[model samples]
Target: MTGATTLFTGRITRRSMSGLIIAVLLVTPLEAFAYDNPIVTGTVPLRAGLLLLILLGLRTTRITAVEAGQLFLAQALLSMATWSVLLDFDPNRIAVQTLAYGTILPVCTLLIAPKATRRRWAFLVFCVTLYPAVVRLTPENLGLLAQVIATLLVHGASVAALDTHADRAELAGEMADIDPLTGLLNRRAALNELARGVDRSADDQRSAAIVLLDLDHFKQLNDTLGHEAGDDTLRHVAHVLAAFVRPTDHVCRWGGEEFLVVLPDADEALAIDMAERLRLRLVDVGVTASFGVAEVEAADTVTSWVRRADDAMYVAKHEGRNTVHVARRTDRLTVERPGALGAP
Candidate 1:
């Protein structure tokens, strides 16, 4: 799924944020003019009010976590400034402040993260669920009715622009996460995929596994033959790894001389056996690597499990290399255990 990810729309949220800051900076004169001239109260304030509404809309429609994260940061800055400037901020005077500030901390959380966690998405879900109640509670004659209506319309426009941007950003991100050399998934892309898989498994009641591979004596090959030959060796090994992975599964270059395989629906025993086969297949492919296998437990997360798998691979390296070691679970999983080749 992460073979290609879009970077960011750079449209709705970024543009909106910029426009808001600009309008807010430029509107002091308007605010003063409106304050002095009673006749121009309705008309003169329109531009500033319209700009604020548009900004709100832009903030509302972001789809990516990074965008969400940046938005939250922007809100925090805006919120603090607004609070400090106002002599007595009240619902009547700054009614939407409640919505503006309340949404900031959580939505800011969403934007800071590259991927949305269950809790973060829950916040969005809450907003979605509570929208009907929001409409019901605020009637047409409510405080700042005109401003709220304008804000809603702006929100709609921003959302439309946001969807367009998200589609592109996801694609850009995926592209960035690819290993340019061998067309394999890069570490970032793989991590994202594995995390997503764990989420899916949790939601659907399934299983998954992660295998780590390290090419034994790979440094020797580079030292003796040349870096070019070593690269060719790695590429060839990548070809073997690609063949072993299921269409649904994925393989990634987990940095120098290391590869990670994400296997969905494979348990500990089965994953260990699969690792043995993968280890042997490298021999057939004319390159060899020490193998370490780790399974995703009911309680495991992508980060913890990957670290465990990496630890197991190191154990395999320590035990004379060229073997497979399955990560054992203790109170704390330490891949520092003695390595041994086992049943395939």
Candidate 2:
């Protein structure tokens, strides 16, 4: 199968798994309570079914884990009310319900709650579960409360550890894709983004361009002002490039003294305008860069597109540094200098 087809299939499978988990969680309580009392078998399923429908409808709101925990507590309370009103509260039945809730509710909370709110939800569950026992204060009820507290602590700790590990892994992935010197996207990340841009431009039939920038006389600057000055210059240029571009655009440090900007849905004119603006922006920071712009073509690969921009940038350098040069469809060059109305 094609990669796109495989990706679609994988998404469907994941969504199916999520739905199955919810279905199991909804039905498990009904099954557990059914065996305890015959009337519960009839009433619990109806209540759980209605609750599931409500939750399903509210799924679009992106409910948080803490809210999910609270909902579960509400369900438990409703069950208790049913037992008390219809059948008269039996101590043995209440104990059984509490034991079931202590085990299941914490596990559900751990699965859904965000890391920031996980402990809070756990504490809320503990307090809610102990409310019934607190009212009576008998020895056996106190023992039940203790069991619930222990269950929550053990499960909460496990969830917190898992969340910490996941966060570390995510941070490591981000660090790998970032340029340590300039704090811009590194070369690998830039290339990956370009590939995605290419696909999107093709599918949508929209224009896109890549700009290649090289700081003019960078080595001379480094020798005259020291490497520390060179580093500061690069950081300043990176900041200017990032700030000037739209959020939809991407700026990356493509190795020493070089940067690449990917502009989606932009034509050659728009690309040249952006490049010139960037060249002007850096003058305030005591550096100048040569820019080359190339619009996407039907025959272009990622390598070819970048190569075209690179060739145009060299043309800008040859025309006396600190200018914008655009690579035309016919492979000819159009050079734009400061204060010029049209490229010559």
Ten-residue segment with the worst summed lDDT in candidate 1? 335-344
Each model's lDDT: 0.62, 0.69
Residue 22 lDDT (model 2):
76
lDDT of 1 by residue, 1-344 (tens): 22233443232344445554464548546554634534334443554454454455444532333453354344444433444243343434344533443343333333343343524452553344334324433674364645554564465456436644775897797789879776788989888878976885787667788889888878778988999998888888877778776666788998988888888777888788878898888887767677878877667788888877877777777666778888878624343443343311
lDDT of 2 by residue, 1-344 (tens): 00011111111122333453376566768665655666776776766675575455445334433344446556765765565446644455555555556555554554445555655765566556545644543564667656655765676677668757866996798799899998888999899888876775676567899889999888888888999998998888887888888766889999899999988778888888888888888877678888999998877889888888887887888787789888876664454432342221
Residue 336 shift from truth in candidate 2, angstroms: 20
* Cα distance off (Å), candidate 2, residue 230: 2.0
Clashes of 1: 20
Number of the predicted model whose lDDT against the real structure is largest: 2
TM-score of each: 0.49, 0.56
TM-score for candidate 1, please give it. Answer: 0.49
Which 10 consecutive residues of model 2 have the lowest summed lDDT?
A: 1-10
Q: Residue 105 error for model 2, in Å?
A: 13
Candidate 2 achieves a global lDDT of: 0.69
